[model samples]
Target chain A: MVRFEDISTPARLAEPGEGIGRDELSLATRNHGLPLEALRYDLTPPGLHYVLTHYDIPYAEDGDWELTLGGHVERPLRLDMDELRSYAAVTTRVTMECAGNGRALLSPRPVSQPWLVEAVGTADWTGVPLRALLAEAGVRDGAVDAVFTGADHGIERGVEQDYQRALPIETATGDAPEILVAYAMNGAPLPPQHGRPLRLVVPGWYGMAHVKWLRDITVAAESFTGFQQATAYRLRQEPDEPGEPVARIAPRALMVPPGFPDFMSRARVVRPGDHTLEGRAWSGHAPVTAVDVSTDDGHTWNPAALEASDDHRWAWRRWHFTWTAAIGTRVLCARATDAEGRTQPLEQPWNRGGFANNLVQRVPVHCTGL
Target chain B: MVRFEDISTPARLAEPGEGIGRDELSLATRNHGLPLEALRYDLTPPGLHYVLTHYDIPYAEDGDWELTLGGHVERPLRLDMDELRSYAAVTTRVTMECAGNGRALLSPRPVSQPWLVEAVGTADWTGVPLRALLAEAGVRDGAVDAVFTGADHGIERGVEQDYQRALPIETATGDAPEILVAYAMNGAPLPPQHGRPLRLVVPGWYGMAHVKWLRDITVAAESFTGFQQATAYRLRQEPDEPGEPVARIAPRALMVPPGFPDFMSRARVVRPGDHTLEGRAWSGHAPVTAVDVSTDDGHTWNPAALEASDDHRWAWRRWHFTWTAAIGTRVLCARATDAEGRTQPLEQPWNRGGFANNLVQRVPVHCTGL
Candidate 1:
């Protein structure tokens, strides 16, 4: 786990909480991402939702943990979890994927928590928007970045510091790809495994922008050059180049119909006959323009039926592909394009962190009846 | 597991050996394939080798299993394992990939044993060549297909029968991409996980071509229409379209020097510096004509150093790409073309069975020290 750190200050010592034990370790214990097989449905069940974390899930006690708005703000303010709850709340369902999704598939895989194709999930986030928080704090002129701090902290690449990341002030203030300081998940109070009392839910960006166990929101004058913004979660050309900061989940799609396992299973066994394949697709960057499936290994593709889309920009739209299963093994594949024509590649463009692997998904099945 | 059944005769009743219990069910328990991360190394260790099976690893006593040659031959012959060993033996290092290697990557994945990119491995096979055995059996006129039968059997899609498959007679007696009834792996006696007493090793083709637990070879005058051949292992467009029978390993390449996972990890994280990236490439149809790597996705590609060529047609040649790792997330990708000029597609043409997923490998890595 790469904990974004601010080494400029004395490192905040980690407070004691429930540490995950070896016996309790699971993909979930490590804050596992959503298993592909879990996508076998339209609405993602809260328990089945994917989870990605940059550090251990922090245990927070309402009395000890608080959200403070300071730095370039005219009125600095601090509020305990209870006090923060007094603000009006809104609910939005958002799909967030780690920038590092499909990292292992990359050649010369980047180092970090080895990730596969999971690292993504969707949930209904309930809380106050950063705009509301920033308004109350009264941001002063020339606030360039909103530096967010989390309760999680650790040593990253030999540097000890607290988990922190920053968003351009414009993003924190903008309404599109909305930013939320969430206190609940899927209609329930956030679990400790998630952010617990509070977490930043940046709808469009990768998980790195969503600071979990969020404790402080600082409006800063200069661009925050904390390790994460300047070093980690970036696409670089050379070892010394802190290329582009990894941002928004790229255009992509996924489908989970009933009967798929919780993990990748080779192909589904079916009687020789007609069958319908269905799933969901979404883009953090733009609306999904098209969803397609190929029964002939992509030699040809058929457009799938998509459900009516609503105003929720971050929610994935459902789709379906119907085909017949002959007596033999068959490969089924799906791909999606966004409003800007951003479709998945046959291969995901590689990044050092293996982020945003939106490669076309291929599925194989066997028509056992002969 | 989809076992081939030959209802033509009373089914070869399954003899259980280490049957996997519900608690033991796992990718490994169901005769799993290699994990993609294991491909980081050139030569797959016997322990790390991938295993694909249509049925449970049957208990084949050497005394009970024998190779029998009959039908359209000058001399019908049967030989026990020891007797078969009396003939001259040759050893070859061959890399075999399951036709279903990248099945899960396909959308609406075909139903079968779910396999990802790790369904492949390289191993040293020791045995007598089939051409030599065919020579001894003496080919009679009118022989067209060499129908091969295995000892394992079960009801597949409701048909009770023995496992069976066939190959063109010319391939059975040809020299390139040699075929062998192997008895040993990596110089050790074949374990039950592999074919215990004897198994066919058809290098370059998918695992289905390598019929396990060999029992009989029947030289016939027409194509064999067994379920495994006529129905399964075929790439189809429509259910009625037999499409094409999947054959020969498609041109493909994989590389991981060391310090990678047994499965796909996000990207290999490393300190920024110059690093030598290397691995192996192979083809069943034509010799690997060329291999190219791109540090910057597919925008540009540089040829890597391929090991000196040799007479071994099925042996994968090693290649190396030396480049510097810059900081942040970077993508490394490799693509291979064969002698026939068949290069991996930016997307492998899709097929119903999800066979021949030889798409280029894309690797992601993080240069952690920035």
Candidate 2:
């Protein structure tokens, strides 16, 4: 029999000249990215939204489901679906992106899910505030974290366990960024593919923190070092290094390709003349303040008009640019700057796990008369 | 300037020892497959269904959209969304599989979308039967094919054009297998990713035949010679050889891997005990009549109990087998046999385009105490 504690290295960069592996291809086939064209919509339709499921989408009947709050909590409670839905519901639009969004684009890329720049989406979620539940459960003194456990169980690296991740107590119950136990998406009951019945939704954070198929919320007195928290989703240069944990999503901007694409290569072709280029930009750190567009690669940048409002503070803001095209091959790029003054980098520093590498998008287009 | 007709080879295999290219990886990111665990659902959720779009999903408002039927039809007609919906609607469950489902599994695989099974789903489609529309338009006596043109346009292999495919006139108006102009899926209006407003759903055929973002139906006096119909999706051994066209889906069965999986490799780990091996089997040629299960790869097979019914003529059938697990490592496989005496091949013949490959699935698992 194999020992349970014999775990292996958590993250490794792909060897030189190594293309995407079959295992990574398998993950790609199962999870999907948002087509950059889908940026046209303010709230992405569920089917068009990018998805990254770490394990099997757990099968659960909502009627028979229960959520338990225990451990360091003063009042341990178990609530069924009906009891859970009894709480007042609030709906909010939030943009969520995977930490590994640009993994495949990295040099000596990580050998995990091979994602491009499309692994991001904005959605309207409806649920009860997590703060309300925490208050009702009565948190005890000295509770450092609230561990959320999902029904999805699987092995990661060499350790087998249910999917679990913890949030600092302040972040979990903070008023500035309301955390939710969402039961609905875009006004409809959550579909099976998107953590049906119920799921956790943490605004302004990367998708990994929003545990799906949630079953338990255990208030803990100490930091919880689960496999997902301390192992996989981290930034490190070497195998022995204890990397900084990945948390909030980095600022990013993506433009809708201005013209039709080649079927296989996806190279764009457009007619010369006046055209309006539009896209969406977001930052989990702060509200997006400015967006810049470049027609001749990143050599020169022009400020674009931003359509921002107080209503979509946690969601992506729309931006547009008008250009008079000439002809020949050209490269287009877009970059965003958040209110915190953090602009998207042209080239991100490489890390072993390939987390939060939000490099500006570069699109190639051939302009000519159609 | 690039000439419009300067086309290259329609299909080419990957160079020996070369891994999947970045272009193929890009396609994999945009498209997605049904997770094997999702077989538990009877009608697949739209977001989880396999999607393979050759070009951008055309944006069209339902109120202004129209489908034109002309050429060789005695009474040419243009029908708006309202007019189309006024016809009697039929709802049918269909299991659609991509023609290139097992493309990546082949040696020197075709360098396009790198799919490995999982590219299949069953859905309840609601729409007007194609025969009714064809009868109203009155197909002319000399008409031999009904050419479908979708609004999605792009360049494939150096040739730029709108997406187009064709069905024999008889097949388009046949009673045995009704084709539809589908507008709704799973009782809701079709999502944007699934060709919102209107699309063609050809029952008992590969997904390529179900043209999405449909804009026109032109009856022709000759068979279509479009790139998708005449070049791509064809089964061939050499690039120079004109091969047989890919149409119906071949017989195939996939088991839901027992127990949990390793997050990276996706290899299953099960506790040593009795487990029910369950899966879904399907074929476009005919109803699935039998299913077989093997624990030791394909070395030995045992008959499985099929839960088939005439109600789901064009949909997949459920199958189950009981197995006792007490092993270190095991490879489980499932195979299906259709009513037409066609059984899934143990090993599929290699083809240039990788179409209609139905090799039995092999799932590696480790059975031990958790």
Candidate 3:
């Protein structure tokens, strides 16, 4: 079982040799009291790692399910779940992140759980390519978009609601094998919370587009504008003017930010000694090009090696570095850059809604001389 | 009631003069739906309109509330809903569109709602400037991003989910007075489906970032990353690759594609001798500089008279021109150019998800000999 106390790290890292605060330390240890496992690696403990679910887990008994492919096509066909699984199965490791991972830290803190980091996770997924199914169904030239609907229900305007969204046709049947009708997670049957029978594994989109309890798939020459498409999962504010009538913002193609922030900076301690620094680097768009560690605050820098990943496209690589200290207090920092040359900035520009927060992350660690 | 059937228009313009196949007619109708009141322009109309909600219409009596401002300020205070409503509210005609407006038309067809070209609507919104509230709250430096949270909720993996997102602080307290903490929509107390008590109105963004059930606000040096941030609203597909792992996609700023296909061409069955052709022209990132209408399809074109708006940033203007029709059948097309010298293209390159579909739209109408 995963014990929060055994693996709980303070939200803010403590300075070298400094005693951690009782409140902060205790707060860190309180497990929502759930049982979890710790799959330890050099980086993110496998047990404490994140998991993304597209559709509710479907048991084998729900076996006789069929996937219907119709609309703007020469031929339409219905394939059962068994028939789909019969195709060549492909497995890939991918890192999934919630779009609003850094929203809690925004000023005028918006009403949210205020996740203090740790909302992202990577996992190996196994599924059948959607392209195979589309080809089997004989998609036609005029096909424009595909719609995916899920079984989960929620209250909207006091009425029970089912979550649904769509993707353009190009993404639905693209040559890229990223689109999946996934059936397994981390090599195991999907958890109940995660979509089980069959879920779309769209690697590079916000979680909203990855529907849970997926029930239906439709291909058409037009796009779908259900509640999720037209009303929800959108950016309400304009880029230039914060206070304007809510306009629908487009889904930005995901790309890593320009720079990585120094999450270990501003650390102080009651006790001081040689200190080792650590942090994590990830991007939804590109692989980590390099990670640089700095000690003397910002004056000097050293390179940190990144851990290898099974799939370079799906997981974040962790980095660590050690620093020698002989004085009272010193600031520690680390910065990461992606292969695309985007790096974290010292500070991100202020926006009304904090959709993307890849600013230099600084943690205060107080150190005392030993 | 809001009756969907009443709002729909007859299929007069779509059908070819001769008998057309049901499949063809369906395809044409799906690709293009005419506005009920094509000529009656008043921004957003009641029947054929768009609605954005905040927190499921705060429970009427309980909805009477106030906005409180505190933290790192000279004075902590509360602005009651009534008193806040007393502030001068300004109205501006603006066009609001879902970022996924034309997503269905994309090749491969992404997994999204089948939005039938009617996801866009224009309306004159009335709201008090957010700047006034910021001034009253006495915002201090170091404020990075403003977070907005709404009352909307759904159960995801047994977790009670609240819709929330954030924006840059500069956008929240920017020079433009376009940012509004809206209390009314189209001269009416916001409908329950629309944030009744209060909601943040931002122009030019997708609808998701606007929190529906706004409640509390907090200021911070950093930003927040909840489920919505980390998962729900991000892109996971690699933008650079035609098809890469979805996880390889990074969340970037939203982009609005310019120009609509065949936007300048329209046909009217007036006297069979001479008729006027017209269409709307606008851009999300820049203002429309000129519009060219073509009656002979794309063979030749004439400049159309462009209407002007007081604030061209938020609204799109209408343009029209006259043309002679020679009975039988003729193809009409329209194209537009923006201030940045970007002209409408015949087609757009296919992307995996089809987030930006600004290809020139084509509508073919048949005129019988009168």
For every model in order, the TM-score on chain A comes to: 0.88, 0.97, 0.70
> Top model by DockQ, which number?
2
List where candidate 2 sits over 4 angstroms from the true fold: A1-10, B1-10
What interface root-mean-square deviation (Å) does model 2 yield? 2.2
lDDT of 3 by residue, A1-370 (tens): 2122222221222233332222221111210100001112323222233332221122233466566667777678676767777889888765555544444445533322233333455566677887777877778787777787776543232222466677778878884436888777777655434465667777755555666556677787776767556543444344343232111111111111111111111012323455445555666556776787665555677887666654556555666566655444345556777767777665543344444555554443333332
In candidate 1, position A50 carries an lDDT of 52
Model 3 spans > 4 angstroms off: A1-370, B1-39, B52-63, B68-77, B155-160, B226-271, B296-300, B310-313, B328-331, B349-353
Which CAPRI level is candidate 2? medium
Kindly list the per-residue Cα lDDT of model 1 for residues B1-370, writing each as its tens digit.
3433321122111122212111112232233444343455455644345666564345466777778999989999999989988989988878888888766455645544445466677878889999999999999988999988887654454444577989999999997667898998878777665677798998878788988888899999888998888877787866678678888888887766222211112224556678888777888888897889888866799999888657667777888888887666667788888899988876656777778878777665655563
- Tell me the deviation in Å of residue A12 in model 2: 1.4
Docking class of 1: incorrect
Candidate 3 second chain TM: 0.71
Instruction: Give the alpha carbon lDDT tens digit for every residue of B1-370 in model 2.
Output: 6443332234567787788878889899998999998887778876998898998987777998899999998899899999999999999999989988988998878888999988999999999999999999999898999999998988898778898999999999896689999999999888887878899999889999999988899999998999888878788787777789999888999888888877777777788889999989998898899999999989999999999466989999989999898857788999999999999888776788888999889997787775
DockQ, per-model, please? 0.02, 0.64, 0.01
Docking class of 3: incorrect
Ranking by TM-score: 2, 1, 3
Each model's C-alpha lDDT?
0.69, 0.87, 0.49
The worst-scoring run of ten residues by lDDT in candidate 3 chain B lies at B257-266
Per-residue lDDT for B344-370 in model 3, tens only?
666654444444455655544444442
Model 2 chain A lowest lDDT segment of ten: A2-11
**Candidate topping lDDT:** 2
How much native contact recovery, as a fraction, does model 1 achieve?
0.01
